[model samples]
Target: MRPGDIKILLVDDEASILQFLELGLRNEGYQVMTASDGLTAVNLVREFHHHIAILDVMMPGMDGFEVCSMIKKMAHTSVIMLTARDEIDDRVKGLKLGADDYVVKPFSFQELLARIEARLRNQFPHLLNEVTIGPFRINDQRKEILFNDSMLSLSNTEYDLLRYLVINHGIVLSKSKILDEVWGYDFGGQENVVEVYVSTLRDKLEDDDHVLIRTIRGAGYRIDLP
Candidate 1:
């Protein structure tokens, strides 16, 4: 999907950050949603499906990790955790808990935008090709994915991962392969990142009858074709 075609949910207790991000994203041509807390964010997820979410790790009610877990249980939503904590452990924990990416606080919005765009590009490279796999119909050119004739809202990372699996249906793609293919060389050997994305995708896509993507246990993942 095009960056402008993507819708993002921005969750933070800081009203200033929410306003800043919303304005920035909107100026970049993206549809943006804002929530001040985890409860509101979860409610928004249930109400309006968004392509991706930017969640603050520190909040009053529910923290980012809790919010991410909730989102993972819901749909194949891509989540990027924002935190002031720059510890490696914090980063690892977030990824292990199912976040697609991590951005440190005081980060450059330009970098965030770049990451979002890269994720989207990897997912919808064709951006205009109409293809179907099981109950899903994807129009790459149109930047749309439909499940049973209903539009499926996917985050930039989710869209890219799903599209990659669809394009390489029936092939076992190891975590390393997926990291390289989807995130490119700049991902710098982050294998855990691949696992997080795969887990998120499974949660979102497996709800339907056809299970197109499957885990290979100790190996990696594959797109199942019947």
Candidate 2:
């Protein structure tokens, strides 16, 4: 999706920082929402579906790490932690807590925008243009998947996994392969994440008697298209 089509959430307790970043991002054609604190950020998360979130590490009531964990559980929103601390431990902590990227204070707006674009491109690769598999259709430009002409309310992660499976249709993809492709190469998460997402997709796409995605026993999962 284009920058104009993507929604971003900016959360910082510092009013000046929030306004500066929000104004810069908005000028670049991104739909930007700003929150002054972690609590307000959480409330905004519930209200709107954000594709990316720029969260400040130091916030009252709830910290960035806590907020990141909460948002990750709710949706597939990619997170970038903003902190003045340049300590290695702090950066590692944010990554461990599921933040896609971290930026230190005093960074340029151009740098931040570059990072945002990089993360988005990584999530939605260039190869994901459009693919049709039987009754299912994937349109990456629109960031949507259609099943029998109806749109599927899929999370970002769900859409990526489903699109990957359809691209490699009829091939049994191992969990490790899927993890690298869908969750990224350096995703230090459990393999069961793939299983959980696959199960979710099956529930949404499969019928009681028909299975679009098949488990290949010791192999992996495959979507057999006619």
Candidate 3:
């Protein structure tokens, strides 16, 4: 996915800091949402599906620790605590509450961006790189897949399904989740279409032994990538 496709949440009680970050990140092509308080930030997390959050610790009502906890309980969003205090106690508190990183106040904008990139690299590495697994190579930019040194002619649906599985390799994705993601939530197609498409992809990849994609019987499908 491109930079604009990654949604980032910015929360700071200071209006100027929030505006500065929103402007700078937007200039860098990020989709950003800002909140001045913790409750609004939590509500946005529930709706925006943000990939990462930069939260200030000194908020009025909820504070950053509470917001960080709420966000962790609900979403898989990576959190970086932004605060003026550099005390080890505060850092430890944030880390114990599931905050992924810590950024001190008075930090440069470039440093913040670097921290964001570092977090993305650790948390969602698949989003920023082409995927290669054994005999398969996936170029997301070109939306092309090469298998065994041969390009596979894939329909759009097939490409989407394959790429989704490849990026999320080894994760057991349920039929309902796959259906909503690949076929879209509004798709009128039958759920069995996922199974059919899986078979088609396996055949195209020449996986007659079904070793590439494994079915968990009662659970779902997981792609094993080398």
Candidate 4:
């Protein structure tokens, strides 16, 4: 699924935890909805079909375990239960109650992110393969790119740059920022490299007039359909 297309639900009684996870996941490009209680979480899930739900096992009035079962019956959304207790019974109970995974409290964001991706890979594998933008199709698994049904041969650097541009399509990307993201921090002081690669990519894309990837004069480069 596209970043904007992948919706995730976050439920935690702790406002701090909800804020932390919402901000972190949003930066990673997922659409996030946070609830401070189980009822609100259920209401959100019932309203929108979220791809995943991260629920705290303990809550007032209703708990994560109760929320998980309700979510499963209401929507196909996958559940990842969270808790401060690392008890086996808690894990098993959450799993048995329709939570796809269980995460102990104090877990690193990276670990939770890994589990979220694992669930996506299993349940929504198509999201991993093809991400289409305008006339471009990027297949990260095969390391291949297709434009207008024509597969383009590209070096690793070129491929990364193109994918980055396609991902953030229509946004002006400054040379310094491109250098940092596409070429790494070690590529600092090499702004000219961005020009060279853009030139090559334009040529390969048959965009001789720079219509596909336009130079924003004094600003930077932006890709827009001609």
Candidate 5:
């Protein structure tokens, strides 16, 4: 999707930072929405399906971590936490709660823009919009997956994971690599989440005697083309 086609939510208690990000992103042709606090951000998220959310971690009432968790559950939006706190624990905590990336405050607009672009590129790779592997057919543009022409209901995370696997079909992806690529720069290094999602996909995509995703022992997982 083009940058102009992407919708982004900018949340920060500080009006200056919020306006800065909104203006910068809009200059790049992106559709931008601004919120002064986490609670407002959450409400906006529920009202609109934002493609990316840049949240301030220090918001009053609902913090960024809390908002990130809520937004993750609501939509398949990529989240980046922007905060002045440089503590490692806070970064890890945000990632664990499903923030796709974290940025320290006092950051340059160029750097922030680069990070936003990187996140979008990673989440929505520029490749074939549609792909087919084994019995599954995937429409990356629409975020839809089908097994033998039968549609499979998937959450945002499930669709992202499945899309990544299908894009790299026949290649073994290590847990760490998958986490970095699919979950963004930080995921609290929760490798088990990958396992859980993979299990869920197999149960939905696999038949009695057939499995689309396979474990490679100590390595990670692969979705081999059948």
Candidate 6:
């Protein structure tokens, strides 16, 4: 998906910041929603499904950390916490609380926009219908994977990795390629995450009935359909 195709929620008690982000992001072709406080942002999230959110740490009523926790609990929505605090503890706390990323206040709009784009790319990797490979089927739209007519439970990362492989069935994809395509640049060379999620997918998809994901020895992995 492109920058403009994503829907974003921007929350800040500061009217100026809210307006600035709304205008800048909208000009870049994104569907933007703005809330002046944390509670309103939570309500907006409940009312509509946003692709990503830019939240201010300081807000009236509720704080951004609380809102971030609420958002993370509901779905795999990407959130970037915005704060003027430069303290390392605050950043770590936000991360521990489930914020996808964090940005210091006085940050450049270009940087924030870049981070938002990267987050959206990671969250929604494809826009294709349910794809079938051998006995396995992946419903990208519903975020589900099915094997031999039985539904398989998969984590968010597992679903994305599986879908990426299935979409390119029969084609070998290197670890770097999988990381670049599935995790996005924001993942920062954490390629071991690919292996972890692949292991999870294997446990769910590989059994007596199906074995679609195949490792390529020293190369990478692929989805084999036969």
Cα distance off (Å), candidate 5, residue 13: 0.5
Error of 1 at 120 (Å): 2.1
**Per-residue lDDT tens digits of candidate 5, residues 18-130?**
88788889998899999998888888987777888999998779998999999999998899899898999999999999998888978998988877765775565543355
For each candidate in the order shown, give its overall lDDT on alpha carbons: 0.79, 0.85, 0.88, 0.87, 0.83, 0.80
Error of 3 at 86 (Å): 0.6
Instruction: Please report how far candidate 2 places residue 5 from its true position, in Å.
Output: 0.8
lDDT of 3 by residue, 1-226 (tens): 3688788999999999999999999999999999999999999987899999999999999999999999999998899999998999999999999999999989999999878876775577557755555677777667788887799999989998987787567789999999998888899988899999999998998889888888989888988877
Model 2 sits at a Cα RMSD from the real structure of: 11.7
Worst 10 residues of 2 by lDDT: 122-131
Q: Could you give the candidate ranking by lDDT, starting with the highest? A: 3, 4, 2, 5, 6, 1
Cα misplacement distance, residue 17 of candidate 5 (Å): 0.8
Error of 4 at 165 (Å): 33
Highest-scoring model, lDDT: 3
Give the residue spans of candidate 6 off by over 4 A: 127-226
lDDT of 1 by residue, 1-226 (tens): 3456677899999999999999999998888989999999998997777877899999997999999999888876778899998989988888888888888889999989866654454443443246666667877666678767888678887887777777666778888888887788678666888777777776776634335667788888887765
TM-score of each: 0.58, 0.58, 0.58, 0.58, 0.59, 0.58
In model 2, which residue pairs have backbone atoms overlapping below 3 Å?
none
lDDT of 5 at 154: 98
lDDT, candidate 6, 1-226, per-residue tens: 4555668899999999889999998899888889998888888887778888889998878999999999889766899999999989989889999988888989999999767755654466563344555677777678898888999888787777877787677789999999988888667867777787888777776633335677787889978877
Mark the regions of model 5 whose C-alpha exceeds 4 Å error after superposition.
126-226
Model 2 Cα lDDT, one tens digit per residue, 54-89: 999999889999999889888878899999999899
Q: Answer with 3 or 4, whichever has the higher lDDT.
A: 3
